[model samples]
Target chain A: MKTDPESHQRMTQRRQEGHVKKQAAATVEKGLLIVHTGNGKGKSTAAFGMAVRMLGHDQRIGVVQFIKGALHTSERDFLGSHAQCDFVTMGDGYTWNTQNREADIATARKGWDEARRMIESGEYRMVILDELNTVLKYEYLPLDEVLAVLQAREPMVHVVITGRHAPDALIDAADLVTEMRLVKHPYREQGVKAQRGVEF
Target chain B: MKTDPESHQRMTQRRQEGHVKKQAAATVEKGLLIVHTGNGKGKSTAAFGMAVRMLGHDQRIGVVQFIKGALHTSERDFLGSHAQCDFVTMGDGYTWNTQNREADIATARKGWDEARRMIESGEYRMVILDELNTVLKYEYLPLDEVLAVLQAREPMVHVVITGRHAPDALIDAADLVTEMRLVKHPYREQGVKAQRGVEF
Candidate 1:
């Protein structure tokens, strides 16, 4: 009852092909939610990497920079020139530095509105919500509203959220999550100022 | 004229603040074109790192896998799950492996079609064209077409073309170009076959 060598080889090849097909099916689905969280400086930097990656692939991408009203960073400066990417920044500025709660909330809402439009319209394949944690931290934007918008986004639209202290609800809803733990910081110790290009 | 100590102190503080502002401005204006070209592996891996970075910052990203038609690679597997990114593959499999020349050109044309749509639409901040060199090397896709696509794309769109044998035109248009020369490969030198998670 032994199988022929030639027949066995044919069966093996068929099995291999089947496996490859199965793997392909697993990845062909659309849309995703990715979050980057931690006490490190590169959270936004990491998100920017994905933005550029998408641009190269020629997919529609929309960006909403929350709590960062200044619009004076390297990412903004360079990405502003990209035709495919839509860069939107809250004109109000930072909360800790600005020390204006009302102003922060107003700015957050403005950015959130634009983000909501992009997410709902399905005009963009991917939407990035940067420094969202800061908006959540200051309670400038409601958590429920954020969740609702994310939930309402087109089924195939991917969303990225970045910042420290990601809300538990956001984390629960996210398809993938990455947390960057900070072991040491120059600011916390010797009070060294953040360097350009590296920090921004 | 001799200045008083108080005035000197005030001037120093102002100068320091001005320096910080200048640094921020410089970072904002600094343009970049990052190329990860090489014979060694990880060009796409490094490019993916950039993708994640941009995504974290809420930058819009697009990805185009040129010669790779199969969807089972680990890189695609990981990124496929990201909700904040959009990805498109040429789906021609490998050029060297595919037997039909006309079919290969048609596949390349389809990929270039999609890539052009993404570029002209101005919807992405960065676009990653994977294994494009292999297409250029085979001449299935004309070098001028690639150049025109890059040139016509938004000036701000940061383009990254991966795979081996990058053309001189691409390198010339690129703001920053890197050549990954293979010192030693496991396949040709060690006779080790491609491994999942490592090669794919």
Candidate 2:
């Protein structure tokens, strides 16, 4: 597998050339519909990280969390404190605790109302629908309705939706989709209690 | 496919019971060797997000970036400005930009030196080795050496290593590993230029 130095050099040059071409060819720019979903983790954390990047650029962002509202989390508190960020935690709590379809649907609708405003009003450069996919998976919000709203959002605003079991329609509609597949989760596999900073 | 509401309620309660049991069973606590790998976006972003989480808890963090020292990044600027964070940007630029093998190895070693200090010193609760897996993949630093250092690090200090093509040994050693699989990437498939706030 190890090529000679000259061959290695040629391969590197070719790779460099291809990279340059790809960079040059990528000229189109617009808003991105990004989805982060899978069984692993970092789905929402990555969105929060993107929100931080926007904040670093001094851009305003709106964050709406659909689930995990039952307990206090550091990310919610941290982002909310920033003047440029508007963070909202929705739902009665963990869906398991509620275990009521009507209540879950109601909470999802209320969260969607706030999310729809952020996506439609163009008030922020980036909007994060944290755990929206989980709601959609449970049919708390009609998938078609959510997709239609997302499809018609402002042209230059990026929206990141995160959670497990992202529907196929959303994946098809998304410009960027990353599935955070679990190789191994510390909490579930390693018997590690959800730590304050890591899990929350 | 849809069950009756009564059946659904029973299912929900059963799921809730399982959730509670899992939560209760997870009692072990220790520093984790977390790896973010695979060919996808958000590997480094997730690590940065974890740093933010630590910051939210008012905990100090050390971040050592391996390959992205090429351009000015908003995350670096933001974190560097924070009093509690020590951020170091390493290497000349991208791997393709600097295709010198010996030079690349030298740079990787230099960066690893700084990283070793943060990880071993235990001053910070979290240490982020951004793009370290890329260096490992290139064999710039012998995997065994890096693994040994990581294994001997302080018990309560967490280390997050990120990049694509994580070696099997690293995965085996990791306490948690989440592979950010590329379901779809806008920059490649959609011909979208890497956006400022999102890509960086």
Candidate 3:
């Protein structure tokens, strides 16, 4: 007995109709303020993944590192070398190691300055403010000033802010916010070290 | 009136000592069951990002996509072309589109066969089971069999599972679990569509 292939056509047609309706409902187009926060891993990693996606589209990107020191991360080395990416590593190290509030604040301000320039330059389609939430959480930079700068950026420039402990105000202002909740972490529980490439 | 640089040297020395102690404490080396779940985005994207990092380390990766259709995703096209990557797209489409429980179950079983092969082949250091949780959630495949396959894989192989509605048993067995909570989604709030390179 021969089976009819046309039986699947109706299913495909219904799916197409649903998809078209959904697509038509989505009409807004503009740059977005995206936030990745909470205590889980993959916040910065996901942001860098976004950078890769943008790079695939041949779009320019700018990165400003806040609290992560000058540790040689493979992502920075790889993505930085890309012609469309402008990478900046600004902080000396984590605040605990520095132990100087004034110095940490100074470093954060400098990084913010660079981020502000990138957001306003109209050169990059996406700008990543890596660990900016940590700085904001620590109050190194005034919350209102940071928010104002973020709000006033070019309408078509996508901004990604990543770190744990994102400020409530930032969450309120973001177009997209993902909280990477820590369901489990090996470093804390199993004492497994952060492996190269996997952690860096 | 020149300041002494010796003070900063002491700080660096202390930090180095602390880091050495922490690094020395972590000695376990084995395979890991990593899960990415919840409502927000970046679950599968983060897994692909892990693939990129593993590639940077000259590692081989095998991807088994269960629920994602043969939709020409940029990630599949780009990663599948890599010399060190093996990619497979086994599903026709999402279950809603297929609208046939028996057909979906057959497709899932076929995908699971491929996944079991990859896990047992010992050729891949990292294997990604994209959207497998959805299949398990729908009971298309027996959860016990899936868990057994995952548990019995090569000792050094890292398996990453991505999707929503992951079973509690899987979560309990996982070494690491990250739940991407939806603080806010633009598609729901602003009616912004998923753009190419960003969503796919």
User: What does fnat come to for each candidate?
Assistant: 0.01, 0.66, 0.48
lDDT of 2 by residue, A91-110 (tens): 77777778778888899999
Q: Candidate 3 lDDT, tens digit per residue, A70-102?
A: 223777776789999999998887765776666
lDDT for residue B89 in candidate 2, whole number 0-100: 84
> How would you order the candidates by DockQ, starting with the best?
2, 3, 1
- Model 3 regions lying over 4 Å from their true place: A1-20, A69-72, B1-21, B69-72
lDDT, residue A136, model 1: 81
The true-versus-predicted C-alpha distance at residue B50 of model 3, in Å, is 1.1
The digit string of per-residue lDDT tens for model 3 on B35-90 reads 99999877887777787777777889899999774223777776788899999998
All candidates in order of TM-score, best leading: 2, 3, 1
TM-score, chain B, model 1, is 0.77
Candidate number of the best lDDT: 2
10 residues in a row with least lDDT, candidate 3 chain A: A1-10
Model 1, span A1-200: residue lDDT tens: 12354554465466667655544545334466767676643456556656665665667788888856322366786566788889988745544444445565678888889999999999887788988876786577889999998888787787878777888888788765666444233222323333333244
Candidate 3 residue pairs in backbone clash: none
Worst 10 residues of 1 chain B by lDDT: B183-192
What digit string (tens of lDDT, one per residue) describes model 2 on residues B27-119?
887888999998878888887788888888899899888987422388898788999999998877877677677777899999999999999
